[model samples]
Target: MVNVGIGLAVGALLLFGGWVVTAGLATRSVSAVNAVFLSYVASLGIIGIYVLLARRPITGTQTDLVFALLSGVFLAIGTVSFYGALTRGDMAIVSAIAALYFIVPVVVDVVYFETNLGATNLLGLGLAVVAVVLITV
Candidate 1:
């Protein structure tokens, strides 16, 4: 439970940080792709420094590295899409729509991943989706 709360807090911080960075990029640049690419480069530099200081060895398998790279690519694309949306749409609406990604992991787990969900958990997810809809609408 504590971990869950911490994860939520971290997720909120990421969203807020992303929004601020995206807004700043929009003010200075016209290309969302450029902004996302530069952001990823900066993130990579920061992460590399952290990993070096932590003395963490890169021991992951090729498949794992591939997946991680794919995740980074998708993140860059998503960031560009998000910034473009923010530029064209209301920030509140865009942010709420972006928050739908939270519900996606649950859906993916339950459906494609064949994971089980309790009745209570299903209800909670439903409520969350409803809340997102309400907030965005």
Candidate 2:
């Protein structure tokens, strides 16, 4: 059995750590696009190996496929934009701006998923925006 909360925590931790490393290493490269591309290539290799080892079927329902493809597209766009921003600005500032990306999912959940958008959630969202500003400055 898997723990969803643990998975989320680990995933978020990895994202933060990976971004920090990417910010530092990408600076050594001349082209941010190239850096992003190379990272994806490496991911391909890792994922390929994992698929081979796990021996899981590389198939899914139409819904799964659509969402998986969309995830890849969104992540690719986000990573490229983040790397480009990292090259041109402070890592903290770029990461803070990137954190604002959460707002999209939250809004989508409220509007489409019929999620409860309580006052506490609204206040948290406002604080998130304020935090980005405070941290960047």
Candidate 3:
């Protein structure tokens, strides 16, 4: 299993690369929808290559597949919206707003997964919200 700190660092690095590519595409008069499609296609190719290198049998139950599909749908919608915002707004502000999406999963975990949200967690969430508000304003 990957260490959580390493996983998070890798994820952040990959996301930063994505944002740079998207920003470059945005400057080239690419429509947000088209940019999103292109990015997904590129991601698919990279993931395919990784799967090949890993050489593990891909296996999932029907429920897992359905959940994956649903998540993909939501991801597409969110990406399109984010790309659209990037085109029309300041990239820094747009990115700050987009970063706040973490709140959704936190809320979902607390409400549906019954995950405990301790005082520190709630304080961190509140601070994040305030930081974004301050950035946007």
User: What order do you get sorting by TM-score, best first?
Assistant: 2, 3, 1
Best by lDDT: 3
lDDT, candidate 3, 73-105, per-residue tens:
998898888888878888778888888888999
Query: Candidates sorted by lDDT, descending order?
Result: 3, 2, 1
Measured on C-alpha atoms, candidate 2 has an lDDT of 0.84
lDDT for every model?
A: 0.77, 0.84, 0.86
User: By TM-score, who's the top model here?
Assistant: 2
TM-score of 3: 0.84
lDDT of 2 at 104: 98
TM-score of 2: 0.85
RMSD of each: 3.1, 2.5, 2.7
Worst 10 residues of 3 by lDDT: 19-28
Give model 1 RMSD, 1 decimal. Answer: 3.1
Using Cα atoms with residue i matched to residue i, what is each candidate's TM-score against the true structure?
A: 0.77, 0.85, 0.84
